[model samples]
Target: MTVTAESALAGVQRIIATYAQNIDAGNTDVVADLFTEDGVAEIEGQDTFEGRETIRKVYGQFSPQTPQLHLVGNTVLTSEPGEEVTATSNLVFFARGEEGWGIQLVGTYEDTAVLVDGEWKFRRRVTKFL
Candidate 1:
């Protein structure tokens, strides 16, 4: 199937939204599944995670009880019909602290998404905290 500009944006957006939901829900396994076999994730202040297994292992450190909400916005996508798509989005992370739920992290996600076997998966994602 050809990946048109519209399809690429929509598919990548879906992946972004799904990622936020899964991470907030502490379903890191599901989040890991959203990436390609050799996907890489680089988060600020953390070691870069390469491959799904490593990604899952690292993300497993996050406890479900912590309760985090990842708010993603302002996504921009650039792509060709049959090539990888590059996307960027702003992120606001709200987490439950000792006092209450509040914004704890602000960042931007730079991602490379590829269509693999008719599915859009993350090839590489970099999170830059601001």
Candidate 2:
């Protein structure tokens, strides 16, 4: 299957949307599945997690007990050579608190994605606080 620029962009956008949905649902296992085996998630002011196990652990920290919401927007995707793609997006997080819901953090994610077995998976995601 030939992956065109438009198709690649759409695929990446779907990945991002699914990522947010899984995270919000606290589906850590499914969230980890979105990454490559050696995928890395680097968060500003936090320890970087590498590998699916570590990624699962990071997501586990924010469990269903801690109801949260993830809002992603302003996504820009670029198709690279050799089935590689890069994307950047704005992220806003909200958590349930005594005052109902409140913003927890705002950040941007710089993502490196690659096609693995005909599927796009995250290779690396560097998250920076705004």
Candidate 3:
């Protein structure tokens, strides 16, 4: 109802939108930019990646490799307060390559969003393989 709450919600929306941008455009920088200077991305069966640099490399690996499309919906949980926000949702991703435009992966985005310079960004996230 307050400005902070609205900003926080907007930030959450941005984070989720960025996920779509990252996969569709292969722009990992946008993905990492969703986070702060010190951000973490934890994927299953992989060690946690600390900071944006590691995130860049990881995105590079994914971008060049997979023809991907990430469709995210159904926010199951969310937290607020402009400086801190978190959202959990089901992300249905589609991919194309050898298979050509079929369902690729179904997963969840556990996002930790933070506000910096009055703009919200993701401080960390766990891309849970489900």
Candidate 4:
């Protein structure tokens, strides 16, 4: 890959990695921070969240009793080049309990990211049940 393509991939990967880390670590604010100010998120056939605040609320449902870990598979990524990128990837949702981790939801996320201020921010994230 060319340097530019590599850089773009790095930016996208960073965004995905940070999201997983913050969500798994229960950093709610950080989770919200990963998204754009006007970002949107749709949860697998569930209702669609319209903004950062809305997404925060949806994420809030993952309480201490049910911590979540979202695993994104690279093989499912569909990213594009340039300052804008729209991609979709499969996500394996995990929940923690006394017995240990359990797979809860298996779905896909369609993400629209923009290179804003030299950084990538997700403008929209739509999920579909598989």
Q: Pick the candidate with the highest lDDT.
A: 1
Candidate 2, pairs of clashing residues: none
The digit string of per-residue lDDT tens for model 1 on 1-130 reads 6677888888889999999999889888999999999999998798789999989988888747777799999998854546589999999999897999999889999999988888899999999999
Q: Candidate 3: which pairs clash?
A: none
The candidate scoring highest on TM-score is 1
lDDT of 4 at 105: 79
Ranking by lDDT: 1, 2, 4, 3
lDDT of 4 by residue, 21-121 (tens): 88788777777777888998777656778888877887887645567688987623365577877777778988888899999878877888778778888
- Candidates in order have lDDT scores of 0.89, 0.86, 0.76, 0.76
Clashes of each: 0, 0, 0, 0
- Candidates 2 and 3 compared: the better one by lDDT is 2
Decreasing TM-score order of the candidates: 1, 2, 3, 4
lDDT of 2 at 65: 75
Please say which candidate is ahead in TM-score: 3 or 4.
3
Candidate 2 on 1-130: residue-level lDDT in tens? 6777777877788888889999899889988988999999998898899998999988899676778898999988744634788989999999998889999899998988888899888999888999
Alpha-carbon RMSD to native, per candidate: 1.4, 1.6, 2.3, 2.7
Q: What are the models' TM-scores?
A: 0.92, 0.91, 0.85, 0.82
Expressed as tens digits, the lDDT of each residue in 11-114 for candidate 3 is 68767887687658888778777778899989877778888888878777777466677888776436646467777878887878775788867888888887
Cα lDDT, model 2, residue 72:
91
Give the true-structure RMSD of model 2.
Answer: 1.6
lDDT of 1 at 78: 50
| Residue 48 shift from truth in candidate 4, angstroms | 1.1
